[model samples]
Target: MFIISLTYKTSLENVERYIPGHNLFLQKYYDSGQFIASGRKEPRTGGIIIANAQSMNEAEQIISEDPFYIHQIAEYEITEFIPTKYNENFKIFIED
Candidate 1:
């Protein structure tokens, strides 16, 4: 199943500050077949991340690992997702 994570940063500044750490985590996870994609929201709010997990509980646990979450830079509102449509060539969407 998929999980849609809606993250709201305490401030875009904080988001930026923690982005590098969080990004590395996302990259490692995605490469290992955990997170599919993760990036900042349009206008620079926080980020929207799509992840593949065995269960909602696992998804939540994964979200908890984000540096932003640990540093109090962002708060995540995560939910189960059914991604019926996806663009594999968009460069942002990865099955992993």
Candidate 2:
């Protein structure tokens, strides 16, 4: 699993301009089972994405296709982690 953090580098005006396309990009990945969960941050500065990828390279390749990255509207920070423990309801997230 990977936690993808997006920090806006540009103004909201710039970010909004690409939201539609960005959403489409996100939806495509969600449909493909690459992205599990995603949403904007509390203060709306950026967003977060929980995804499954074979490796960091694969994660980067997936993120590279995001419209936000393509337009340089935000900077991305990816953190990879192993889910060793979680609630039963969360088990699905860690399953193979």
- By lDDT, who's the top model here? 2
* Candidate with maximal TM-score: 2
Q: Estimate, for each residue in 9-91, the C-alpha lDDT of model 1 and write its tens digit.
A: 47666567776798787988889777766766787766677777878899888878878778877777777766667666744
The runs of at least 3 residues in candidate 2 whose Cα sits more than 4 Å from the true structure, single-residue gaps closed, are none
Question: Candidate 2, 85: how far from true, in Å?
Answer: 1.0
Q: Write the per-residue lDDT of candidate 2 for residues 1-96, one digit (tens) a residue.
A: 999999999999999999999999999989998898999998999999999899999999999999899989999999999988888998876787
Off-target runs (Cα >4 Å) in candidate 1 are 83-96
